[model samples]
Target: MRLKSVLAILLISISATSCSLYNKLVYRIDVPQGNYLQAEQVAQLQNGMTPEQVQYLLGTPMLTDPYSSYTWYYVYLQQKGYEDPEQYTLTVNFNQKGTVSDFNLDRPLPQQQDADIKPLELENNKSWWQSMKDFFSFS
Candidate 1:
C-alpha cells in the first residue's frame, strides 16, 4: 500500500513538472509561401511570349512591381524549423512591347535533394520482429 502511494505521488509530480518545463516539446510545421514551380515549367519559357502565355504556363506572379508593370517576380520561401531556410527567386522582365524578353532564375543554395543528406531521426526505427515482440510484451 505504501509503495503504491509513493509511486502515484512520484508519477504525478514528474508529469506536472514535465508539462511546465522547457517549451521544446512544441512541434513546428514547415512554413512555405509563394508560387511553387518545377524545372520543366521554367524550361518551357520562350522569348517573345505574351504575359497571358506566361501566366498560363507558370500561374500568376507572386509579386508584381507597382512602379513597373512590365516586371514580374516569382518568389519561393520555405522555412524548416531545424534547418536553414530554403529559397529561390525568378524574375521575368518584359520590354515596352509587352512580351517575355529575358528572365533569371537564381538558386543560391542547391535543392535539398541535390545533396545526399538525410533528416534527423528523432525516434528509433525498430525492425518487424522487434516491433511484434514489443507489441506482444505487456511492459
Candidate 2:
C-alpha cells in the first residue's frame, strides 16, 4: 500500500511537470523570410498614394485598423519552438488629406512578447523560477 501511494504521488508529480513543460512550447505564425523593408523605402511612400500603390511597394498589410483605412499595420514575429520569439510591428497612419501622418516600428506585438516571458535587458536577469518554469513549460 505504501509503495502504491508513492507511485501514485510520483505519477502525479510527473504529470504536473509535463503539463508545465508543455505550456512553454509556444507556437506562432512563422514570419516569412527576406521580406523586411527598409525605413527609407517606407518613407518614400508619399501621401495621396493610392492603396494599390502602397500595396505595390510594401505588399499587403497584415491588417487594417478598424477605425479607418488611413491606418495600416505590417507585422513580423519569429520564435523558436521552445525559445522565446522576437517580434516586429510597423504601423503607418495617414492624415485626413491622405498623406502619411505618422509611422511606428516596434518590437513584436506586446501581447506576443509579454507572454511567458517579460522583457529584460539580460538573459541572466531572468529569474531562476521563470527560467525553470519556462524550460519545463511547453506550449
User: TM-scores of all models?
Assistant: 0.58, 0.47
Global lDDT for candidate 1? 0.84
Candidate 1 C-alpha lDDT tens digits along 6-77:
999999999988887644567768888888877778889888999999999999999999999999999988
- Clashes in predicted model 2: 15
lDDT by residue for model 2 over 44-94, one digit each (tens)? 777567667777888888878997898998876666455565656778788
Candidate 2's C-alpha runs over 4 A off are 15-53, 108-139
Name the weakest run of 10 consecutive residues (lDDT summed) in model 1.
107-116
Q: Give me the candidate number with maximum lDDT.
A: 1
On the 0 to 100 scale, the lDDT of residue 124 in model 1 is 68
TM-score of 1: 0.58
Clashing pairs in 1: none
